[model samples]
Target: MKLSKGLLADLRLQPELQVPDAALLALPEKVLQFGTGVLLRGLPDFFIDKANKQGLFNGRVVVIKSTSKGDTGGFEKQDNLYTQCIRGIDGGRKVSEDIINASISRVLTATTQWEEVLSCATSKDMQLVISNTTEVGIAYVEESIHNNPPASYPGKLLAFLYRRYQHFNGSEESGMVIVPAELIVDNGTLLKATILQLAAYNQLPTDFITWLEQHNYFCNSLVDSIIPGAANIDTGYEDELLIMTEVYRLWAIETDSPRVKEVLSFAGADAGVVLAPDINVFRELKLRLLNGAHTLSCGLAHLAGIDTVKAAMANDSMAAYIEGVMLHEIVTAITDKHIRHDAAVRFAVAVLDRFRNPYIEHKWVSICANYTSKLKARVVPALLQYQQHTDHVPALMALGFAAHLLFMKSPAADDPFAAYYADLWTQHPAETVAEKSLSDSNVWGTNLNTAVPGLTKTVTNMLLALQREGVNAYLERVAAEIIIS
Candidate 1:
């Protein structure tokens, strides 16, 4: 008997990987990914992995972590390769699969090796740029300039594009299509605007702007995939990069041209990324129905003393509370009639199932991040929408917001849920929940408490109940008065 010392030998599913060594180790870099986080690794790499398996793209990807806090040393240590694991129902059976991603050739972090990053940017083979630096990660800092050693994401992008423009003497053929997977409204357009701002601030040549406008492709897209990051890389899953995720994936792109199809074909993602004229419609629908449910669930479940979604759903009363929040308060609030109602319901149910996936250990603390901001993006629209259709207050939704306000008022951690509200109420003393709501315009984009009749009273009452009886007990009172008939 003999033992192989190869790092990948012990991996349970390594034998299933069919990545050719030539494709895995040495292929022309056609993509420069700006962020090497879970989304790109899971979604885009899944596409590339499929494409390679189908013999569509033998091309390689060069991943660059475009932030000071992010480092690719771990990825590089694994030879710029990793695994993507998907777990969910497939054909009504619970199935899981592990994929060895061979699309990546190298990893570079801007802080440590800006030269390497810039060099990849200058390379003629690099044709596409993908990024998911999160919603807050893509903002422009006016002070950022080209003179800095390592710049902001847009600044770094600008430097890269300038190099590419100069590399081939401003040839239109050298220009690349950039698709950023940041979950912003019109992310590509916003990204290009920032890059153009950087160009103007740096006072780059007018031709550069023209080149950017004429040659480059900045396509807006919506990407959805639940990718749970590694608990610990050192977990004894040797040769296995544990990226737990749901089977669901979406990439809605706004581009009419054949370029997307061509690139998708070239990258082996022809099956995954969908091209449509109105990606925004789908984006809004998903954000409202899917993301909305997650936010409301957190507030409602937390008030019931339910920590994990699975635990929350196990309680029939809490589970019904979530459903009522979605169907009555949330879904009823959406103004757009075109959003598939049946699909939305199914999606909500699917999200619940995902939340209950026994193998996945999702902490409320993680999903509970950005709770205040999420309420605006996720829950409030439904609130406004419901009011528009029917002239009555959504009491359950009001109760959820009340839970959020009380949760904010209480001692809470700095996760997304508590941070903004904590900063708002704690920093500036307000006498009542309504006063807090009225003061923080950022939460609702306006004083919605005044606009919606009886909202403040409802929230105030709910807040009082929570304070007097504690969270779970208060929720029982709410269920008695609001949920239960």
Candidate 2:
């Protein structure tokens, strides 16, 4: 039988499978969700569902599908019900649990149901607005909100807020707590600015703008989860929206208002939902540790014949490089007044454990996608910081940096510098390629060659060595030397 509200009535329960209480199905739609992607379903929707099941936050998500990609047929067919398979390693133990999520009250496609979508703003119960419309979605487009639907995400949101203001007489309590789960830093802050800009462009009322500024809470947030879709486990029922996620999950919300916290009461249900005045600590830790480590190590690990993150963890040399670079360099470099050494170490250990999840076959090549951008954003800051504190080259960073340079030799078609590097490598020697690539200000925001003294030379030497000795031999040799020191 296919999973649906009707199927939930007679479905047999397993010890590991959690089926929501029938009462949860009757909850009010309290959240206005912008995207129907698995990330939102996997993280925010997951938390809300879990909370509702616990009788904590009695709410449901009203999803607005704005993308031109897929239709709402699957959701309608399934009664907006889906399954969540939370799996992988945690604290060095296996985790396998299934949840038939009943968080979504309804799914409305914005194109056809713009009126209905706007109608959600009239719901007095709606207090939270959650969105994950990719990074590009939260952009400014000078389009009219008066159209059947607004042209941009911000426009649509402004229209919704305006409708709410009209319905509630611009009550201070009626404004939503907007939490954007886009990967970009300061997503909430930026989205709010864009919306305010659109409001001006549309010549919106000063009173409405006043209400927007005073009542609404746009919270900067960070969400981390390895939620690959659909585990395809036999549950005696089929679910089209099944999502498989790892044991680790975090949704760090930056908010100051107690009212916002009260509205986001679902946060209490999971340790993963952290509410704070500022989330930069979480942001820095995640970006510099988990993502940065991935960016730094992927090329080297892939070139060393390692296909997956778990495989690299199982390998002695690669494992050493991964842990060493993170603990000795990244953790040290990122340590500040807010970020202490012990805390960074703990986070690193957790990250390493996450990387060692035997069930998660995280592909190195997948991490290597958009290689140039990843290096520029993730590694460059850490590289500079590592040198700033120590004043000498971090051998592991240099090795990883070298591996990145080596990895970039066969330029990706999408890489802007692909042609530049293609011709550079074609025309020059390995040493020159290293210096030129590292020196290119466009590649990294700063000239890595001079900004961090001796970086260009060290990276160049390591790159040449990696080329001469092959990835495994060079990695093994350099990683051992770094470890010994």
Candidate 3:
């Protein structure tokens, strides 16, 4: 048997599986979602379905498939039903749950069903707009919304807003609480700007533009969860759309308006959904702690023959490096007033638990894309901050940096920094690699050698050590020292 609306009847008998109530399926469509991907399903849709079960947010979602690529047949065959297998460690405990999500009422292809997509604008219940169209989807593209469907996501979205303005005669209550889950820094702000740019480019009416600015609330949000493709666990019935996610979920939306809070009532269902007047604190914490640690540790972990994050955590040396760099190095370096050290400590402990999730196969290589740039963005600032406050060199971070330099020797020729690093390696001997690369101001913005006085020596020593002792042996020695300290 395949998982669908019909499967719910029998699934109710299985106490372990969380099956939705029949009444939840008949709720009115209140949210217009813009993506048909797993991250959207495992996070936002999961939250909505969970909320519906608790009667907090009694509404369904109408998804817009903006792109014509890929088959939408899976959704149609399963009646928009899927399973969310939340498996991972949560605050020093193991957690595993299977939930059937029935939040999506239907999936409409925007390219083919633009009229139907725009028609939802007339519904009073449609007060929320959610999207996860990746970072590129929110870009400005000059096009007309009248060509059956607009060529770009911003264009299509503008057409829908215009339709809503026309239907409600530009009423304030008809506005939407727009929250985008793209990984960019200011997703919602950038999206709204792109829409307004498109509106002006298309010569949209002045009143419509004013209504767009005043009525709609574009909320900048940051989402933290690892949806690693399909779930590995088996349900009694096959589910084509099943997704596996970690237990640590965070969807921090920036908003202060009472109306926005009320409209996003589903946030009440889970502690993971945090709504605040300013979410920069959350962003800084995530960037410096979670992402910063990942950037610094990924290359080292990968070079040490550890394939996944779980494997690295299982190894004592790799585990020590992870914890040391995060709690000891990265946490202290973050000087944001909004972030307390205890809070940073707590977040780091939870992050360790997440990293130790055996079910998640988060490969180190996958995190290695844009390796040099990631270091510059996530780690370089922290490194600079740490150097200013302390004279002692950050040993673990230097080792990680050394690992990155060594790993870059094998990059494809087309990578932006590949030729630069290749030339450095080709001209200088292994001993001078650190000094040569660290002194270059073009790639890393500042000359790392003079800026962080002792970094070059520390990094150079570790880079040479890695070449001589290999990562495995060197890691054991480093771990022994960390444990002793």
Candidate 4:
């Protein structure tokens, strides 16, 4: 049987599945979503669906497929019904749930149904706007909102808000809570700034700008979940929009507005939705531990011929290396006066468990995308901070750094960083490559060798050792040294 709204009655009889209440179908469209990607569907929509099922937030989503790549036939065929298979370890226990998410009421392509999408702006029920248009999608572009469907995400959003402003006569009560789930820092702030900039470029009225500034609430939000889509899983029924996500989920929204809190009543229904004045701790924990660990270990794991994160975790030496890097180095550096030490340790342990999730096939190569930039942003800071605190080199970090350089020896032609390094190695000798790279201020923001004493020597030695003894043997030696030290 296919997963569709028509099959909901029969699906309800199944013991393994959780079907949505028939009453939820009539819920008013309250959320204006800007993406049809699985992350948004699996995380935000998942929470909204859970809230609606419990009759807390009786709201449905009107999704705008901002891009013109895929058709909305799947959504139409299924009546906007999709299966969410939650499979992962949570609090050291296995969790598995099959939920038929009915959050999205309809999917409209922005290019074809611009007027219909604009019509959503006038609805009193539409009090929330959410977007997940990727990292680049939140950029600033000087585009006029007068186009049939504005060129950029911010431009489209400006047009929508302008229509709303016109419809409500700049009423304060008609303002919407905008939350962007893009994986960028201050996503909401940047998005709001871009919208205002676009408004200025389009020569919008001063009263409309004042209404936008005083009435609307833009919340910076951070989302954490591994939604790898449903292409690999079988759920006993065909579903075009099936999504698989980890049981662990977090949607940290930064806002103190009473109205924002009131409108987001769904937070009361789920622990996953956290409303806070600041989400920096959550952001730092995630960026440094989970994402940073992945950045540091990915090169070494890939060079060791490990295919997936789970596969690397299965190896004792590789797993130990990852743990040591996070707990001993990254966690230690991140746990300062602002962050609690115990909390950072717990988060690092959880990250290790997530990495060992057997169901998730997170490939090392995928983590190695834009390896140089990731090293600078995620790994280098920890290295520098650890050095500052301890006045000693982080051996594991050095090993990871060496492995990254080794990995970049023959990088893809398109990767400018890798290509630059390749050219550097071609011109300079192996012994000098570490010093050259470590001193490249353009790459690391500052000369790494000058910042961390003996860093260049450590990396050079590790690079030579890796080339000679292989990653496994080198990791074993590092592990033995850590034990002795």
lDDT of 1 by residue, 398-431 (tens): 7777777766665565444465566666676343
lDDT at 177 for candidate 1?
83
Candidates' lDDT values, in order? 0.71, 0.88, 0.89, 0.90
Give the C-alpha lDDT of model 1.
Answer: 0.71
lDDT of 2 by residue, 416-444 (tens): 66677788888998878878888889778
Arranged by lDDT with the best first, the candidates are: 4, 3, 2, 1
TM-score of each prediction: 0.80, 0.95, 0.97, 0.95
Candidate 3 structure quality by residue, lDDT tens digits, 1-485: 99888878999999999998888889999999999988999999988998999999999999999887886899999999988998999877899899999999999998788899999989998989999886338878878877688878787788889999999999989998999998888899999989988889889899999999998999999999988869668888998899999999999999999999999999999999999988998888888888889889888998899999999999999999999999888888875567788998998998899899989888888888888888898889989888876866778889888998898877563347887888888888888999988888887889999999899999999999988999899989999998898
lDDT: the better of candidates 3 and 4: 4
Cα lDDT, model 3, residue 70? 83
Best candidate, lDDT? 4
Write candidate 4's Cα lDDT for 1-485 as tens digits.
Answer: 78887899988888999998888989999999999999999999999999998888999999999988869999999999999988887777888889999999999999999999999999999999999986339877887798988878998898999999999999999999999999889999999998888889889899999999999999999999888887567777789888889877899999988999999988877898999999999999998899889998999999899999999989877888898889889988888988999999988887877887788999999899998899898888888889988999998999889998898898572345977898988998879899999999999899998999999999999999999998889888887766665
Clashes of 1: 7
Candidate 1 segments whose C-alpha is farther than 4 A from its true place = 1-26, 67-71, 89-93, 109-116, 119-124, 134-136, 139-150, 232-237, 266-272, 335-338, 365-373, 409-450, 454-485
